[model samples]
Target: MTNETFRALVVEEVNEEIQAGVKACTLEDLSAGDTLIKTSYSGINYKDALATIKNGGVIRSYPMIPGVDAVGEVMETTSDSFKKGDKVVITGNGLGVSHTGGFSEIVRIPNEWVVKLPEGLTEKEAATIGTAGITAVESINELERNGLSDKKARILVTGATGGVGSIAIAMLKSLGYENITALSRKKNEDFLYALGATKVISLDEFMPEKIKPLQKQEYDFVLDTIGGKVLSAILPQINYGGAITLCGNASGIKLETTVLPFILRGIKMLGVDSVQLPNEKKEAIWERIANELDKERLSTIGAVEEPIDRIEEIVTHLLEGTHSGRTLIKM
Candidate 1:
């Protein structure tokens, strides 16, 4: 593997503007790390899409690869944790952000950031789950810990068509939860229903005609991926002692609401961050995804496989919000 050049999506600053494209790069170009992996697959995430543009708040430096997720076989290692030919998964921990990421045919990452691929998942399946699925499982685990183990609890998942929301709904259903409502603006009712959402409602139906400090308690638990107004609006509607897991901010980041929901309703808000979570916790969640998640239904969650060279088009689709489900990139 000496002096081998590989194709990778490189984001760089050109004349004070951000530009990204596939380029030929050698092993020497990668940032120093403890392990080197020959990437078999990577996933297109919203954060990865933003890393391609100026002021996207994803990439911290220029001429960096922009994929936060990668799964493949180990080619070389300086650590005792892994060996050559062992399959492993890597995501977040500043990958595709402050360091060289997984948008290339080969990636070199620190040994502490890699997790051995779980037994039940294929490389492609693991990539399909990637960061989004891990976030979903983490959010659900928080809800369970807060007393959502009852299958009859009414659960609401916002941004129900996105990767995390969709996977959360499916996982909840698979876990025996009976009442799951999905909130989305897209007209993909059948798709959401196929993922085990018992009911699908549009924004018009979910949001009240007037924003209020408090509303009638409706949901026992809420999995919120769309932050901003959507989160504020849902807060007032949570039942007493209910819980809400906040993950993504696809809509916006600001929240303008009173403390009525928290002080009066006893509603708990749990924040989820998969990017910087400790490797052990991430591995535990990955194991849960491998053992508990319905693998057969994963393909139905809208994973489109693309080669490494075609990532630019998918990035555009993600930024435009026209893409549905996960986009798996094959190396």
Candidate 2:
């Protein structure tokens, strides 16, 4: 791999401005790792969009590649866990932040950050699942562990149009969940319903003019992607012994709420961290997603596919909160 050149979406801070564009690079210029992979596919996350903007706070360093999710074939490896021609999937563990990441034609990462693509999933399918799918599965697993067993139990999914929410709703339906309510600011009720949401509630319709310490019991489970006031509003309506999983914070980080729901109703708030989760656990979730989620259903969740060269357009939409569903990036 002496002088092999490839294209990478390089983000650099020049004179206090963030500038990102696809640029030609070489193997030696990539971050040092035991394995070299030829990226087959990558996916855009909200964090990836933020990394391209000044003061976005997603990137620890500039002149870096900013993709947290990648699926590819191994080109070379010094690690015992992988060899040439093996297919692998990678996400998290400082990727696209502290470490140079996967928004490139090729990527080099530590083997520990790698999970061999499960047999049930193709590279494109796995990339489409990506980090968002993993987070959704993990969140559901946590809820299940907390006694979410009733198929008819009311479940609310916030930020319902985004990747995690959209995928979670579909996966839950496949698992025989009968009652799923989607909460979204966007007017995409048809899309959410197509993904099997039993009901679609606009954000305005779900939020009360005043948030009380406790409200009438509504949902038995809530999958919250947005934080801040939206999360604060959902807490009061959760049933006794219910649970809510907190994953993405696209709505803002600060959560203003009371512990009355916990103290009075025994509600549980589980925070999910997909990025720093152990590789072993990630593998389990990936396998579950690959096997339990129907490929045909997965294909429809986020059908938009964009090449790396056209990423800037999507990035703008993501930052503006106008984008919905997953967007797969072709490497």
Candidate 3:
């Protein structure tokens, strides 16, 4: 392991097909970064799965590492922000998409993208509450607490079984939001309950209840992961002045909706792109997740701490929609 060469999941395009596998590579050949990390953990994300398949176009260059989350100890550093042996977590900031990412034994990244492992979190804990956890926390926080009613506010979280959705349920529960509905495939009902979902509804069951450009005001706030039609369908149902933090496109990328929700109902659709958010904002969210997101709940939401090999399997399963909950990749 001490050798200059280490194993990595390399994604290369061949004859119009993107192929990925574990290969040996040297540190000098890795992506450019100001600091080096002896990766202790990482997570399998949807974007990582895209890198291994043809037509995803996730990798800007060939022979790329396709993982977005990394948590580890600093091995070397040129930036004053971190030192050797310091624990840290990283996600997004063009990580697996462009920069060589956490799918390898080691990762070198810009110091600014790093968040020092805050109190109340370990390498495994940080990875479980990786970008997904942070995104949920940030989305929940986007609602300004300006003397607004707390528990009385209704919140709906869609795609509750996915990484972001599950964590959002836990976060809202911890923050005292009780009138919450979690939408997911019926098979994940038990899993959503374990993650503190008060009410779990089948994605299939919820659909076809009613469809309208504007319906009865229901949820005060909505956290939509299954965007596209789901969002188009839910937007009009949101209570006037309510907000929906748009996160993922798991349902569909193309949005088909009218301005009825935005104009007629005075609804809001806040786009949350975890990949390109400010580094400082991400660092703040990581710290808040450590402090406020509640560790006990995070672990209960299917946190698996395993060696890096698990990441390869996790990424594969994620693409197939088989991997359930969060996977913390330990190196």
Show how many residue pairs clash in every candidate, following the order shown. 0, 0, 0
Once fitted onto the true fold, the runs of candidate 2 whose alpha carbons sit more than 4 angstroms away are none
User: Compared with the true structure, what per-residue lDDT tens digits does model 1 show for residues 176-206?
Assistant: 8999999987858999988999999988887
> Model 3: which ten-residue window has the lowest total lDDT?
141-150
Clashing pairs in 2: none
* lDDT tens per residue, model 3, 1-331: 3357987878887887777878888886588888889888777767777777877757878878878888899998898877999998888888888899988888988878888989888888888878888778778877543222568687889878788888988888777777878987645777777778777887677775667788888888888876877887788788888888888876778887778888877877787778888888887887777777766787788677776555557777777666778776666
Runs in model 1 deviating more than 4 A are none
Candidates' C-alpha lDDT: 0.89, 0.90, 0.80
Name the runs in model 3 displaced over 4 angstroms.
Answer: 1-3, 145-149, 310-313
> In candidate 2, residue 118 scores what lDDT?
88
Backbone clashes (count) for model 1: 0
- CA RMSD per model (angstroms): 1.1, 1.1, 2.0
Which stretch of 10 consecutive residues in model 2 shows the poorest summed lDDT? Answer: 294-303
Query: On a 0 to 100 scale, what is the lDDT of residue 183 in model 3?
Result: 83
lDDT per residue (tens digit) for residues 9-89 in model 2: 999989888899999999876888888899988888888999999988888676899999899999988878778999999
Candidate 2 residue 280 C-alpha distance from true site, Å: 0.9
In model 1, how large is the Cα lDDT of residue 292? 87
lDDT of 1: 0.89
What local lDDT does model 1 show for residue 200? 91
- TM-score winner between candidates 1 and 3: 1
Error of 3 at 327 (Å): 1.5
